[model samples]
Target: MWARRTWTDGDHGYLAELYDRITAPTITTHEPILRKAPDLSDAWWDSLSTALDAIAAVANNRVAVRQEYLDRAMPHYLGIPIDTTVPAWTAAHGDLHWANLTAPVLTVLDWEGWGSAPAGYDAALLHSCSLLVPDTAAQIRHRFAHILGTPAGRFAELVVITELLQTTTRGDNLELEAPLRARLRFLTER
Candidate 1:
């Protein structure tokens, strides 16, 4: 179930969205722990991949993977020039993280940013967020190997890594810095 409403009350304008009422709470895909995480089974990962492929199949002409934006961000964020060719575009969740997903039944929330993005973007974003959990990160890479194995997918992973590293410099997710930096170095190294 999805509903979006735009309203103006007095001088304030608001846009509110009602996603599905999930039975289970959001998965722990964010910084700072609160409680035990839900059991993420292989079947759940399969569902995620299936849903992602379906979503990517949808038609969208939007330029979500903005080359100008990526090129401009790379130098400032990762301090490296992105000389690789930009990959072809496909639909993506834009902000795919563990917190946006629900367990038991797969439900991806926060669709406001969904649009055309680089291939393997959602997978890379998920992998980027799972850096703290090495096992989960490895599972994601394995599940989406076909996409992540491609040249465009590697570039997408690098882009996500750069973004994650940039976020860490701001003092957020400090624990992930070491792992992210190591992965960045591994990718950038000849």
Candidate 2:
């Protein structure tokens, strides 16, 4: 799932090492949870909250995201705030999840979405997916806080907002109607 960017064998090796460094600890600590519970948990919610907070902090000081195609499809959708004002950069998987990662070997397979993104984007994505399992979601959240060194409360509001946005966007797809509706209900009820 790597993108069109060509990589030499050396680059691959470096990436592999980086992946191991980033994911090994979490994987080692959480593989059991992944294998057992795939649904979202209270813990996952907490982790998502923390990640969103970090994103919002960074996003608040940056320029707003702008994309013509996304705007066309979601005319009312406001783009996320991204801090382009900073000169720092970090490599991101763009999309990180259990499916793209392997245990024991600690390999991260998919790389299509890899690029420079805000801090904690990968963690945010992982937390988002972890919501599919309640217990694991909790574990993921706990791990996220440990990794990012942020308080979980910092992210709650923004995570809810982002999840709402994602739910609304997915509502257009018939296959996703039920889950999206449930998420919408959850958002509204809260």
Candidate 3:
């Protein structure tokens, strides 16, 4: 079992970390990000929900996300005012993007950024990742409506979009730049 460890090289300084691998035959949420939507069963989503619940229940002393950080960083970085009022905070896979999640049998990967965040933050980020595929995005929305429809959920969505926009501006994920800009404008226009 890999109990998260950090390493620093004595040379040019870097640590290669390792994780106990999850099951095989799993396709990442974004490996072929723009590919046609995967055939998923309702059972898969149910398992995903259960896993997210379990992860949220885990206790960690580190504050991966701070209220003040969100209050300050988001607006200044995105040039969009935010609703600083946070309604709920729970353990979140902070970088909940397609590349980090696995399909068929759901298995969330990437733990480096996991931390307490706005409730439904994971769902919002995942949904945003699916924007390239409308049907998949809609399905995600339907499944997580209870969370995504709330004001706090919308705030989480904004954070997700802001991050995508910032990444785009950095010349990364250039394919998403246009769509992410539109999404950011749509969310902030109200």
Candidate 4:
């Protein structure tokens, strides 16, 4: 479903809207709470390193989250460089995974957490989810790199942080919590 939707800018925007609706609390309400609690994973860390490299390569700039602010610190902790002063926005499907998409026929499900967000957010999400399977993750990253005309280094880091942000804000779902934590720690550690 995403393959087809990727072709239409309108569908992409709509998907972004849906993702925002579902995951609104994380960005708007719960981020502060999660920052204080330290819970994270090894797999998430591995993925975060890759993600950070990818973003750095694509943006061609050093990315760091703001200091003394949890919300800002979190993204930087996960290797996504965000400048509070700069306006760098793009439509994002806050949650984009195979479970949220239908195969055979293209239909993207789960449109609750959509919104305008950092660049490469969707690609990062897709790559992070693919991490569950090594081959799958490699393929996804490769495809993303090809599509974006860049390497998939920091992409996973961005996605992991994004996931952490969501899990922290919204009530913890057992399935997502573990992975999100893992990713969070992975990115935050020096």
Point out the higher-scoring one by lDDT: 3 or 4: 3
Candidate 3 structure quality by residue, lDDT tens digits, 1-190: 6554555666555444666767744445435244457677898888877877776777776555678867876886578666776788888877766666666777777777788888788888888877788798888889888778888778888777766777766777677666666767876777
- Please provide TM-scores, in order, for all candidate models, with all chains considered together: 0.85, 0.43, 0.81, 0.44
lDDT of each: 0.78, 0.43, 0.73, 0.44
Alpha carbon lDDT of residue 24, candidate 4? 16
| lDDT tens digits by residue: candidate 4, 67-170 | 23435654554445543332343445546555554323333455455654455555666555544445655555565563333322353344445555565456
Residue 184 of model 1 has an lDDT of 75
Worst 10 residues of 3 by lDDT: 26-35
Model 4: residue 147 alpha-carbon error in angstroms: 5.9
For model 4, the superposed segments whose C-alpha errors exceed 4 Å read 1-87, 146-156, 165-190
Off by over 4 Å in 3: 1-19, 29-34
How far out, in Å, is residue 167 in model 1?
A: 2.0
Could you tell which candidate, 1 or 4, scores higher by lDDT? Answer: 1
As a whole number from 0 to 100, the lDDT of residue 31 in candidate 3 is 54
Q: What is the clash tally of candidate 1?
A: 0
User: In model 1, which runs have C-alpha deviations exceeding 4 angstroms?
Assistant: 1-12, 29-38
lDDT of 1 at 188: 78
Query: Whose lDDT is greatest here?
Result: 1
Between prediction 1 and prediction 2, the one with superior lDDT is 1
Candidate 1 per-residue lDDT, tens place, 115-153, comes to 887788989888877777777778778889998888878
